[model samples]
Target: MKLLLDFLPLVLFFGAYKMYGIYVGTAVLMAATVAQMAIIYAIDKKLTTMHKATLALILIFGGLTLFLQDERFIKWKPTVLYTAMAVALAVALWVYRKNFLKMMLGSQLALPDPVWNRLTAAWVLYCLFMAAINGYVAAFFSTDAWANFKLWGYVFPLAFIVGQGIYVARHLSDEAPAEKTE
Candidate 1:
């Protein structure tokens, strides 16, 4: 549900771009993200730091794409986003001496410290790899090609992310009983 909600704007952006052109499509996408941010603020009364950063990137990069009338700007958005995430994760573990994923996921997943460290490393590697792929697609392909990659390429990493989650779950403590809601 959360994923679907978060994805709505991107879907809308793609649909609009396909039907119209970059200017209108970018406008629609920007508005959609703003609406989502509004809802988040309304619901939580305080914007999360990550959410704020994401919104800023969307505005700056997305706005530049529209203003400059260049599709490459928007295409580079993912590279920047993924690279920023990877650097943040890597630096958290290496320099800050903290497990970044734990800060993000530990509340829901009761994994051990070692598991958290390994998972954080995996995420860092994943981000770095995806950043490279995003660059390749955007550089070598047409705008449409890169957009399609953005839309379809999501499934690949997400599938792996889920698989990693399941693998992590296997190591859950035997004493930690499962809770099933009716």
Candidate 2:
């Protein structure tokens, strides 16, 4: 459910692009992101910082794309977002001596400090790679190609997530024994 909600805007953007064009696709993306945020807030009663940041990026980049009549702004959005995440993770882990991934997922996942550090490092590197690839695609590809990449490139993240899950599962402990009813 959560995954679908998170991806709804992107799916809509791709569909709109296929049916209409980039400009109309950008408009649909902007509106869809706004709607997604609103729905998330309604359900969760508050938005996470990540959600707010993503919404801000979508609005800013999407607005510029429409206003300037150039698709470059939207094309660069993922690069900006991925780079920011990489920097934030690196800063939080090294400069501040904080493991943000652990902080965020500690309740659901249990791992040693070293494991958490490794996970954080992995995330930072992954984000950097994603940013670089998106930038390369945007700079070298045609707008139509870039748009297609935007939709198809979801595979990278999905694969990364599955790999991460597999890595984490190896270290995961079995559930605590259930208590017997009186």
Candidate 3:
């Protein structure tokens, strides 16, 4: 359910682009993102910082795309978002000596500080990698090619998440109680 909600905006954007083109697709994406956030807020009663950042970036970039009639704005949105995330994570870890990922997920998952540090560093690198790839495609490719890449780009994140899950699983403590003897 949550996963569907998360993908709904991107799915709608791609479908709209296929039918109408970039401007219409941008509008659909903006609307769908708003609806997605509303539904998430209704269910969770609060939005995370990441959620708010995503919503803001979508609206701002989507609005610029529509208002300026430039596909570049929408195309560059992902690059900008990924770059910002990478910088934020890097700065939080290096300059502030704080791990933002650990701060957010620590309550749910208990891991050693070293593991958290490694995870945060991995996230920073992953974000920079994503930002660079998106920027490269958006700059050199045609709009149609960029749009297709945006849709197919799910593979990268899916792989990253699976790999992260595997790494984190190795560090998770076995909290289950031992079997009782007769």
Among all candidates shown, the one with the greatest TM-score: 3
| TM-score: model 1 vs. ground truth | 0.89
CA deviation > 4 Å runs, candidate 1: 174-182
- With candidate 2 superimposed using the best TM-score fit, by how many Å does residue 121's alpha carbon deviate from the native? 0.7
Q: Clash pairs of candidate 3?
A: none
Q: Lowest-lDDT window of 10 residues in candidate 1? A: 172-181
> How much lDDT does each candidate structure score?
0.82, 0.92, 0.93
Query: lDDT tens digits, residues 84-157, model 1?
Result: 99898889899999887787666667778888898888888888888899999999998788777877888978
lDDT of 2 by residue, 1-182 (tens): 99999889999999999899999999999999999999999998999878888999999999999999999999999999999999999999999999999888876787778888999999999999999999999999998898888888999999999999999888876773233489
TM-score of each prediction: 0.89, 0.93, 0.95
Clashes found in each candidate (C-alpha, N, C closer than 3 A): 0, 0, 0
Reference-based TM-score, model 2: 0.93
Query: Clash pairs of candidate 2?
Result: none
In order, what is each prediction's RMSD in angstroms?
Answer: 4.3, 3.9, 4.7
